[model samples]
Target: MDADTLRAILDAQAMQQQKAFDAQAMQRQMRHQKTLDAVMERMERMFSAMGATPAGAPASTAEFVTNSLSTRLPEFTYDPDSGCRFDVWYNRYEDIIANDGSTLDDAAKARLIVSKLDAATYARFTNHILPKKTFDVSLDETVKILKELFGHNTSVFARRYAYLRTQRNDETIRDYTGLVNRHREMAEFNDVTPEQMKCLVWICGLANPEDADIRVRDLRKMENNPQTTLKELSAEIQQFVDTRCQALRKPAIINTVWYVSQRRPHWAKDCDFANKTCHDCKRVGHKKGYCKNFTSKKKPIPKQKRRSANNVVTARPKLLPPLVSLKSANNTEINVRGHFNCNFNIDGHEGRGNCHEADTTSLLGLDWIAQDEPLFRRLTKGAICNVSASKLNTLRTSLTKQLQKQFVTVFAPGLGRCVKSKAHLALKPDAKPVFGKARPVPYAALPRISQEIDRLVAADVLSPIDHSDWAAPIVVVQKISPTLRRLLYWTERRTQATPAPTSNA
Candidate 1:
């Protein structure tokens, strides 16, 4: 068997044997006491057989007078009924019993019986007396017995006396002082220093040992801690030692809900004290948090925006990759046809309205006549006939009347066709109808709209792009400009209708 297992088995057997021996001894003592009581009773019966009066029984007057007499009988009268005769007999009897009682008492009789008991029984009885839960004997009596038994000196007695006195108080400090003082006179006693004594007291605070005198062996524990200081040694000293110090033997990693003394297991692995050198982000005497190497290694790298493959960036793309793919797919078959101008030369048609030219410089200029070939083709196909010039003019007039009717309903008065500016025109016309100049609004009658718009924007009355700054100054006008209000309202509505950026993206 392994040494530890064998040791454990031996310990368990020894404990069982000790317990059995204690129980057997107690039983033997009880039996022995019963036997002693029986012997005492037999002796009392023997005394009764000899006509001795029982103790505390009333005696005759003659017996009282003769009770103190010598054992030698004096010459006496022979009257059987006389009190003197009974007294003479009783007095002689008492002296003989007194001499015999000395031999009968166990303390006196033990000298004779001591030779009869076997060595094993005697040894067991002597060695293992029943344990005393409390010490009924006085300290002085204990000292006297110690002196008689062990021949220990006065210093030991004095130390014991001091220890007992201190033990009577609450057990906080271990009585290391008392143990040292007791053996001071002895050549072999190695006294503890004051610092070591303080360390012991600090250990006592952590230990909470039972209210008993501390022993010399327990004070020897302080020798293990060479670095413990008097000021630093407190209950917290154990925590510091368990956490910070490296020792000859490995300490058990303990878990408790009380203040954590040790670092976590993972942290302990990285601990310098455990490894004896810093393994993680190595530096002397410390692990990562306090490591100089770690601090130096963490030099910041300056961030630079990575150059793109195209090396071009406008505004950040609002479209997703999948959306861009879908747009590309839909635009694959783009038509690049250009526009050409057309003229509507009129013939006889009474309902044909007079054509008016528009100013070429204005953004809404419409002097050149245009036609939609797709619409004309659809009209001729629906009629199932090719149109002659007069007939075509009549049809064209009818279509123009229809378009004008719809346009008047949709647009405000004095606002001409909403056409693209000449800068935006895609075609150079070959042939087109010409007309007289269209009338313009007088300059005097024009509102200072652009100046008013600038003033409104500068006052923080108008939003830059989004009308979302509610805290800005409110737009106030003496009289409402319907055109300007309409324009601003439509812009605000359209801006709000568009989707906002995805917050997560």
Candidate 2:
């Protein structure tokens, strides 16, 4: 192209780029204004609720009002059915509004901020963000929101603790651990209450009085301070713990709780407390949620794991499937009830199936069915079996039966029929291969036998012979069964009936 033409093209491209950049800048500017507008709106609504103005109001009155409201809001939480919001109002001319020609008034901003908090976010902020250990609808609106989302239970917190156990590198656990320490300090020196102290100890697994002695000192220090009230101290400690806990890497630890709440079609009343017991109160009927005494000096138990120096060990978050009750589309109960091991039909045959069963160490031997020797030995010695996608159901069943049978025979005799020992029960030194199906018999004909051999090898009944990448041309498969013996015998006869190839000179 000519120099003049190239200059003109470059100029046009530059103009287009500048235009795009200007548009993005404008959009960003608009968004920033919107956020500021939302905050101002909240301030305004709060001011209005207090019957005062943000600016030009008596400085003393504004101070007194904001301080009082901050304290009262914790106790003056709005009922979900009340449709009441703790409003903060702002004067338009006094604050920075957007230049977007939209009337960025206080009401609009408040709505935007409130709207930004969707159901899930609101639930999280309510249940988890609050500082108190117990579930209280009467707490500060924000605190209530977090509690409502996370709920009062060890389940969510327990899973979080389990997740922290997986981080082998100390740094990951250290981040959260450090936050907890800070909260411990603040609660100790500020407004830590008996209830809050108990909850903190329980959640962090620092329940023992000896373990919590350090935290208890901080609480005593806070109580000695003449300035702080129970409300102020509670909020501070709550904020302190929540802030540190937020730094945790496993955000999804609580996400399962969120998912169960959203997708599972049941209210709080439907939850079953039968299987759980509170570590604090030691009550039989009530779980952690209804526990009145929050104070329990329990230190979190550290999980043990074998790891390399460079490896990061984190906790395994336990996943408990939500209780599912079937109901018709019309909201009628579907009467879905049965014992765990009711008759379940498998392959057109009635068989017993129990979803819940305990594992025994005896059946742990059968797990080596598909592992290399070293890996198998590692698992058996540790008595730890990694659940595989293929064998999970079978393994669960085998372990359950073995445990039940052993318990009955050893602990409670005459409870059930005892298993008779046989030669197969005695494990051999090379017992690993004995568990799996035997290798197939080999074929005589080269090309004809290759086809049959291909099937068995593909099915994993036969491993490669002498590390050859491809199947051997004239290999024979061993260990014939009656069913396969008949098919292979017929195949050999058919191949024999055909004449052999002869070379001509």
State which candidate has the highest lDDT: 2
lDDT of 2 by residue, 401-490 (tens): 887654433433322322232122232344222112234544354554566556667644445555432121232444456345322322
Off-target runs (Cα >4 Å) in candidate 2 are 1-106, 122-169, 172-189, 193-505
Q: Give Cα distance to truth, residue 39, candidate 2, Å.
A: 43
Off by over 4 Å in 1: 1-121, 125-196, 204-241, 244-505
Residues 122-164 of candidate 1: C-alpha lDDT, one tens digit per residue: 3332333235211333434432332333232323323323333
The global C-alpha lDDT for each of the candidates, from Candidate 1 onward, is 0.42, 0.45
